[model samples]
Target: MKVMFSAFVAALVIAFAAPMVLNQFGWSVAEQTSSASVRLD
Candidate 1:
């Protein structure tokens, strides 16, 4: 029972945190690409 409860909590935390983490990473990548100084000139 305790193991199941802990697993449920872990899943909940991951469900909530995953999106935020992914968003931050996506935004960082986008920012880097947009502000890249290595122009293909």
Candidate 2:
């Protein structure tokens, strides 16, 4: 039970932090899709 609790906490922290970490590198889902729409227009 202790090991499972620790693993759950670690996963929660990573899930919350991953997006902020990725955004620092300028990776974005909206930017990519918007550019494609502009090209089609």
Candidate 3:
């Protein structure tokens, strides 16, 4: 249970932090995803 909890926390941190790190490199992930979603509609 402890192992699983630690893994889950690590995943959550990565999920939230990855986008900011990528954005610092000028990767418009949110913009691209939003535009793609709009096009699908």
TM-score of each candidate structure, all chains considered together: 0.62, 0.66, 0.61
Overall local distance difference test of candidate 2 = 0.84
- Candidate number with the higher TM-score (1 or 3): 1
What is the descending TM-score order?
2, 1, 3
Those runs of model 3 whose alpha carbons end farther than 4 Å from true positions after fitting are 29-41
**Which candidate tops TM-score?**
2
The local lDDT score (0 to 100) that residue 6 gets in candidate 1 is 100
Q: Please, what are the lDDT tens digits per residue for candidate 1 over residues 1-41?
A: 99999999999999999879988778666665686466686
By summed lDDT, which 10 consecutive residues of candidate 2 come out lowest? Answer: 32-41
lDDT of candidate 3 over 1-41, digit per residue (tens)? 99999999999999999988988887886655565334434
Extract clashing residue pairs from model 1.
none
In TM-score terms, candidate 2 sits at 0.66
Cα RMSD for candidate 2?
A: 3.1
| lDDT per residue (tens digit) for residues 1-41 in model 2 | 99999999999999999999888886878755565435434
